[model samples]
Target: MEVYLVRHTETVCEKGICYGQSDVPIAAPYLEIFESIKKQLPQDAIVYSSPLVRCSQLASYLSNTIIKDDRLMEMNFGNWEMKNWDAISPDEFTPWMNDFVNVSVPNGESFVELYNRVNDFLENDFQHNTSKAVVIVAHAGVIRSILCKISGLPLKDAFNNKVGFGAVIKIVL
Candidate 1:
């Protein structure tokens, strides 16, 4: 299967805000951006998206029937959600900063947990699907996790994939 992992476009939130799983909307002037992204994808592929509005909006525009899955959500930042990163207490993120791959945020999940859940979706839902091509509209973290899983990268180095907003990455499974 050819799976295209597409990150949602920029959000309305300003930089440094931790908006994970917060259902933020896409930035303004998204129509042109969405159009460009649409040009890169297969027109008749099975499409999946996070329930978050940012991703759902893009998915809705790209596919007539988009499958909204909770598994595709960005990592839940827990107490950090919707807070500016600089405003957050440094002490609060110290442990997670030290070992984010293994450490769960306060009331949130670890990268391991996100990886596992995404893996479950891939294993059970995606793998069993019959479509020759699939499109996944989700967050950077989810796209990075999928890239790491498919490319044999360590969770700690997931950032290396550089999943820019509205970017499309196609991988075969």
Candidate 2:
């Protein structure tokens, strides 16, 4: 199977904001970008997306019937929702910084947790689907987790991967 993993377009949130799993809007005039990415997709690809508007907007361009999946959502940040990364106290982020390779956020999910969800999705697709190509519209964290799964990279390296708005990574499984 061929998979096209796509990150959502630029969001309304400003830079440095921690927006995982947050329901945020995409910036206006993103139609051009969406159309451009849509053109790159295989015509018969099944499109799936996180329920968040940021991802939904982009997914809608490729297919009106976007399969919304909670499993594809970003890692939940809970109380850290909408807060800037710098605004979080060092104590709040320090533990994660040190142990995020395994540790989860308070009242939230971890990279490993997100990976399990993504893996389940992959398993279902890999086992039951016959489509030669599929498109997944998701968050940077979700995309990173899948890439880590495919590349055998550690969660710490997920922080260093750059998955930009409208970027698409192809994987053959």
Candidate 3:
């Protein structure tokens, strides 16, 4: 299967805000970016998206019908859901920053947890599909997790994948 992992465009929230799984809206004037993204995708494919609006918005533009899967949602930030990075207590943030892969936020999950769900999605849902192509519209974390799973990238080096907003990564699975 050909998996097109697409990160949703920028969100309306300002920088420094941790809005994971918050259902935030994408930045305005998304049509241009959406169109550019569309051009690179196969016209005929089953589209999947995180239930969040940001991903759903882009998925809708790409296909009339889309499958919204909770497993594709971004990592949960728990108590830090909508808090600004700077506002978070350094004492509380230091441990997670040092070991984000295994450390879950106050009430949120860690990268390990995120990777589990994404891997499950791939193994159970995506792998079972016989479609010619698959487009998944999700967040940076979700996309990165998928990349790491398929490309054998270390969890610590996930940032090296360069999952910019609206970026699309194609991988064979």
How much RMSD separates candidate 2 from the native structure?
A: 1.5
True lDDT of residue 61, candidate 1: 94
TM-score of structure candidate 1: 0.97
Pairs of residues at least 3 apart in sequence or in different chains that clash in candidate 2: none
Which pairs of residues have clashing backbones in candidate 1? none
Per-residue lDDT of 1-173 in model 3, one digit per residue for the tens?
Answer: 78788999999999999999898898998899999999999998899999999999899999998999999999999999999999999987999999999999998999999999998988887745566798999988988887887789999888888899999888887
Tell me each candidate's TM-score.
0.97, 0.93, 0.96
Residue 2 local lDDT, model 2: 85
Clash number for candidate 1: 0
lDDT of 2 by residue, 11-103 (tens): 888999998988989898898888889888897788888899898878888886778988899989877889999988888799888877677
Worst 10 residues of 3 by lDDT: 123-132
Angstrom error of the Cα, residue 114, model 1: value is 0.8
Q: For model 3, how big is the CA root-mean-square deviation?
A: 1.0
